[model samples]
Target: MTHTSTAQTTTDEFIRLGLDVLDTELTAIDGLRRYIDADFAHACELLLACTGRVIVIGMGKSGHIGGKIAATLASTGTPAFFVHPGEASHGDLGMITAADVVIAISNSGETNEVLSIAPLIKRRGVRLIGMTGNPQSTLADLADVHVCIAVEKEACPLGLAPTSSTTATLVMGDALAVALLHARGFTADDFALSHPGGSLGRRLLLHIHDVMHKGERIPLVDESATISQALLEMSRKGLGMTGITDAGGKLLGVFTDGDLRRILDQRLDVHQTPIAQVMTRQPITISADVLAAQGLKLMEDRKINGLFAVDADGYPQGALNMHDLLKAGVL
Candidate 1:
């Protein structure tokens, strides 16, 4: 009993510590609101007006956060990259040009590696923006614009680990990236261009024409085709559905496996019953130019498993099913 109680107490203590850390980090982030003044705006303006890339440099934990910040900025329409402070001193400093803007990150504002290269960076006539905990430190003084990320205390119990400060820095980076993203009128289409291999890219860049069955692959039958003939087309095309069209190739209605199941109990004569008699009238159709992702949403909203891509004149142009969307990675 005593051992069990001890285990329970330890679990409770761990939960409390985790909550305390979250609270501390949240407080630290809230404290940054006061520091988002004119200096932050100037930094954004400088970055926006730059003709060259944005260079991010830092040391230790700040380096990891700086790398993420740089990636966020680059992916959100701003051209940016990360350069280690230690590497900048050796040879990577050549990557920076006079047309570029450099963002230097250091919690103490006195990191030797970062401070060592500050003067050289300034000599290139490049604009320098410093992010540090100290507003009056040497790095802040050397910087043309200083953004203070001071926190009341570290979330680490020992007060040594970079916990709250790093979180604040990352949040500040996101704020800058998002502000620039909106200012430049960056659209989802632009974001998809950079993330073509991702799920968002598939959803935004892929259209119905890219994944739908076309020409001979479309499961379709004449409006006068018997229900048995429509079923044969459905089976042959393997899309679990068939569209009923008129002699002029205009879509009239649709019949699916679900409809087949429903009519089975009604004892409908498959050999003589006209497809248009049992087919769903004016079925939901999508345009070939519509995004495949929107097609998926339409199917889900209407609780369907298949759809036909039709022309503006209501002629069947292509067909697709949920499986096609899954294969296209839009699912």
Candidate 2:
């Protein structure tokens, strides 16, 4: 029979226990700020000097954290990946090479599977970086560099579970990645290159010209065109708006589908009136080279769903609507 702790039977006691776990972790993180030393510096330098990819290896909980760290590093311009120590002993060790730097993770620093292949890693002339709670562990002693991720207490109430230790290890990994990112002078553009399918990549990759409907495909009419003619152009282009331009292609104003509906509701003469008289003046426009994502923001910010692409001299060159943004996945 399992012994039940009477103290944990109450809901308030359970809540306090949960809060205590978070408190311990928060306190440990706070202390980590001042613990930065030469080891952290050396880890960053070692990774910077690496000529090949980083091969991260760990077991159990550390393995999960290692995978995430590898993914973060890879996405942030550092090429790294996780490998299971158990699988490495079988055949995955072939993936390791002399040019690569190995990051070994184990809280106890004495995992049998990890230590079993430690010799082969060194034999292959691979640099080993150990992350562990114990400073004097065998893994640390055999490593070229050791990053201590020690925690004062476990967040687990049982105290035997990995909690604060894993958090500290993850923090150390992030610290290394950010340090390397700055050292390499990694920029947003570099990050966008790796995340082409993401919204951020869309913002960086797309420009106004790419989405803008140009040439005769754009809904456009001259200032002299009647409201009926402007409505026809708007319908033909299906952009729900028509731009008014002069003989020199300079934009004068815009007539939108909303304007047409409003005029019709008031029983205005569409056939007898000129579009220039009723057009919206000083309309919002964007440059062809402006980012499509920025164009989308402009539309949202100004409470408009469409924009006219204008030249440097304010001539209408292209047009786009919210549908274009949706198609480009910028919305």
lDDT of 1 by residue, 1-331 (tens): 4544434457788899999999999999999999899999999999999899999999999999999999999999999999998998889999999999999999999999999999999999999999999999999999999999999999999999999999999999999999999999999889989899968899989999999999999999999999999999999999999999999999989999999999999998899999899999999999999899999999999999999999899998899999999999999
Candidate lDDT scores, in order, read 0.96, 0.89
| Candidate 1 lDDT | 0.96
Q: Which stretches of model 1 miss by more than 4 angstroms?
A: 1-9
Give the TM-score (vs. native) of candidate 1: 0.96
Cα deviation at 73, candidate 1, in Å, is 0.6
lDDT of 2 by residue, 18-91 (tens): 89988999887776775478887988888899999999999999999999899988988789999999999999
* Angstrom error at residue 183, model 2: 2.1
Query: Best by TM-score, which number?
Result: 1
